[model samples]
Structures are given as C-alpha cells and as structure tokens.
Target: MKQGLGTQLRHLIELLDGAVQQSYADAGLDYRPRYTPVMRALAGGQPHSVSQIAESAGISQPAATQTVALMLKEGWLVAQPGPTDARQKLLRLSAQGERLLPQLQACWRATSAAANSLDADLPYPLSETLAHAIAALEQRSFSQRIRDAKE
Candidate 1:
C-alpha cells in the first residue's frame, strides 16, 4: 500500500475524511465540509477575506465566496468591511457559530474515540512511524508539485 506513496496517502485521506464527514452529517446539522475548514481559518485570531479563506482551505475563490454567502444567510458567519481596505470584507463566526463550539468539540471527541476504538493496540511506535510517513508523503507532494510546475 505504501509503495504507491502519494496515491496511498490520497486514498487514506479521502477514506478517513469521508467517514468523518458522514459522522458529522449524521449529527443533524447542515454539516458542509467547508464549515470545518472555514472555522480553522478563523482560528488564527484574525478575520479572513474570502480569498484568504479559499487559499487556506485549498478551495476555489468562487466556491469560498458562495459558501460564505450561504453561511451568512444561515447566521453562522458575519462580515465587516476591512479596516484599511473598504473594498475587501473580513469574515468571522457569528454568535450562533460561537454557541455551536461545544457541539463541534463533542463531535470531534466522538470521532476520535471511534477511530481509537478500532485498534487500541495497533502494536507499533505510532508517533515515529506516523511522523515518518507524514514527512515522506509531504516531501513527495512537494516534489510532485514542483515537477508539475516545471512541465
């Protein structure tokens, strides 16, 4: 499985993410995947513009803009004009979004517990093995991107 390094990593990531997304959807919220990444972007303690959010989330600017508009309509996000640049708007979570923090936290805990329960004793030095795997995969991705850009 690891021999096809980059492909294996992509597959694993998609599988895990799909499981997590389904879990979130089962929790009875709208549960858009964008919500989680957007929240993570806002975690940096500064309001983000749609472009910034898109870049951080690895999504397209038009998609981010659309999602932000939907979120605003759903009362989960608030937007204000940028302090220095009136043309740009800043995005942040609204009071309703803040109130959902506990729900999000609980969902994360449940997801972790479910995954951990699958193999409590996988029988390996997890940190080193996982760290090495991650580093190797990241390097592979970087190299591939560089190669692609050169082509």
Candidate 2:
C-alpha cells in the first residue's frame, strides 16, 4: 500500500517543522515555524492589518488571523485600532517579540544552512521542486485534475 502524495507532503512538513521547533527550544526560544511568516512581516517595524499580513506572508486571511490571535495571547504581538478604519486592528511585534529577534535570526540562518545542506544531499533541490510543483498546480489545479480523471 503506497501512501498518497498529500499524505507524504504533510508528513515531510511535519518532520521539518518538528525539527525546527526543537531547534528553537534548544536555543531557549519558544517559537513555531508557522509563526515565522507573521513575525517576518512585523519585523520591518510597520504595523499591518490581518489582510496585509496574509498577503505579505502568502497565507490565508483566516490563518493570519488565527496566528495573530495566538501571538497576541503569547505576548508576541500587540494590536492597536486602525486609524482609518475603527473596525480594523493594526498589528506589530510586542516588546517580548522584539527581544527575541536576535535569537530568532540566528536560528533562521542555521535553518537556511541546514536546508542548503539537505538540498545538496537530495537529487533534486527541495526548493526548486516545490517551485515547479506550485507552477504546475497553478497551470492545472489538483481539483481540475481529479475531475479530468473521472471523465
């Protein structure tokens, strides 16, 4: 019984994320790989709305909102009412998050180096493979492929 592509992809992500989380813990920093994008977005010192963060981070709005909520609870983020839109809230890194930046940046550099080493060990680079996969999916989505297969 062979595993499906989606399952394999998910397993790979889990494996990588687990390693990353452990590395952060080892460095005395509590962070999740999922938080990287949102943190990066706020690192520029500009406050952003959920939608802006979603677009900048290439994540869904709901995901950004959820991440923001968790970060707020964790004291990693601070939110203020949007100046123009009273209903919208602008988000920025909290003081605690700022304090963690140096350690996080070190981890990021190490992660990049590790990824490069891993890519060198593989026949095809993971980043390139993912880019190609995304392009192929954009050309013909998996949903369309499944429908075509049923014909």
Candidate 3:
C-alpha cells in the first residue's frame, strides 16, 4: 500500500533528521537538529523572547518555547526576565552553546552541501518545492482546499 501524503512527508523528515542526528553523534556533539534554528536565532549573542525566536527561526511559538526549555535544561542557553516586561523571558546562548558554534557551523555547511547534492539528483530542488508549497498554502490553506474538494 502507498503511504499517505502526510505519512510520506513525515518519513522524509525522519530520514533527513536521522542522518543529521547521527552525524552530530559521530562528531561527539550533544545537540539536536531541531535546536539549530533556535541557536541560529540567538547566534548574534542578543537575547530574544520566545515569540522573537519563533519568528526568526520560522517555527511556531510553542516549538520555540519547548526547544528553549530543552536548551535551558542542557545548559546550552540561559534566560533572564525581560528588561521591560518581567513576565516575559529573554533567552540567549550560554557559554557552552557559544563554544559549540564553530563545530555546529561546520556541520551546517556539510549538511547544506549534502542537501545540494541530493537536489542535483532530482529534477526539482526539494528546497524550492517546499518554498513553493508553503507559498501556495499561504494563499489558500490546506483546510480551505479540503473544504473546496468536498464541494
């Protein structure tokens, strides 16, 4: 039986993330690919709120919050109360995270090269396809499409 679109997409993510995770493990780094976006969002060494990280990282707010919590637990990030709004927290990379940047950046470069190689094998680049799909969805959400299909 063929997999559904959602299942296929999830499997694709599993394949990509699994390889990256293994590479990090092989490099003796305690890191997750999911954390990369957050790290990048804070790479400038400036503290940012969860919403800011979410927007910068192109992830949802909940995902940013969860990743931030995990990074904080691992000592990869530190958080302080917002200067103006004490109720909000601002987060930044910890010393440990800063020390890991050189290695992480190298890994990111290698990952990008690998992705480009993969894209070369395909007629259409996966990155561009994804971007186009996202744009289409933004113009008309999947839910709206589904409703239209029922009509």
Best-performing candidate as measured by lDDT: 3
Between which residue pairs do clashes occur in model 3? none
Tens digits of per-residue lDDT, candidate 2, 1-151, equal 9999989999999999999999999999878888999998999999999999999999999999999999999999999999988899999999999999889989999999999999999999999999999999999999999999999
Error in Å for residue 95 of model 3: 1.0
* Candidates ranked, most accurate by lDDT first: 3, 2, 1
lDDT, candidate 1, at 48: 93
Residue range with the least summed lDDT across 10 consecutive positions in model 3: 22-31
| TM-score of model 2 vs. true structure | 0.97
Error of 1 at 150 (Å): 14
RMSD of each: 5.1, 0.8, 0.9
Cα misplacement distance, residue 31 of candidate 1 (Å):
1.2
lDDT per residue as tens, model 1, 74-126:
89889999999999999988888777766776777887687677546667644
How close to the true structure is residue 94 of candidate 1, measured as C-alpha lDDT? 87
Could you arrange the candidates by TM-score from highest to lowest? 2, 3, 1
Q: Model 2: residues >4 Å from true position, as ranges?
A: none
On a 0 to 100 scale, what is the lDDT of residue 117 in model 1?
A: 70
